[model samples]
Target: MAKMVDQNPLKFSKYIKTYYGISFVEFLNRLKIHYFLTHVDHVDQFTLETYIYQSGFANRSTFYVAFKKYVGVNPSFYLKELKGK
Candidate 1:
């Protein structure tokens, strides 16, 4: 990212931390989670596995941890909530 932006990597990470109040990895994870939630519709257990990788998560456990951290609910329950709305 710093290479792409012509920035020093350390400086760039510092900027992200200051600006976003999160580390660069956290920012990227949040972006990935946001992408998955907004792009997926009609989510199911089988398809959730697919979308986990599609959202750039390496596996279900990591995705579940990140989802629970940021979204405040598991994906399945979140989908159910969305469906209720």
Candidate 2:
């Protein structure tokens, strides 16, 4: 997700130090958001299942759980909102 900040230097940099006291799980959640938004256009469960498998998540269920916890919404909902935009 480093590329997300590289492309939006100012906006991302603002949060660089804000995660200092956060938990590792929270950090992972942040990365998940960046990953989701950056890859929203290419997302497909079969593909994501392959990609996220290596991230220590056994399956989409776990990933979605953490994703919803931090994002306050499911990826499908986020995608729907983006489409409306």
Best by TM-score: 1
lDDT of 1 by residue, 1-85 (tens): 8999999999999999999999998988899999998877746545778888889999899888889999999987988888888
- Candidate 1's C-alpha lDDT? 0.88
lDDT of 2 by residue, 1-85 (tens): 4575475644454465465656545676667656665666655555767555645566788778887887789867876887787
User: Model 1: how far is 66 from its true place, Å?
Assistant: 1.0
Model 1: how large is the Cα RMSD against the reference?
Answer: 1.9
TM-score of each: 0.86, 0.52
Task: Provide the global lDDT of candidate 2 against the true structure.
Answer: 0.65
Where does model 1 exceed 4 Å of error? 42-46
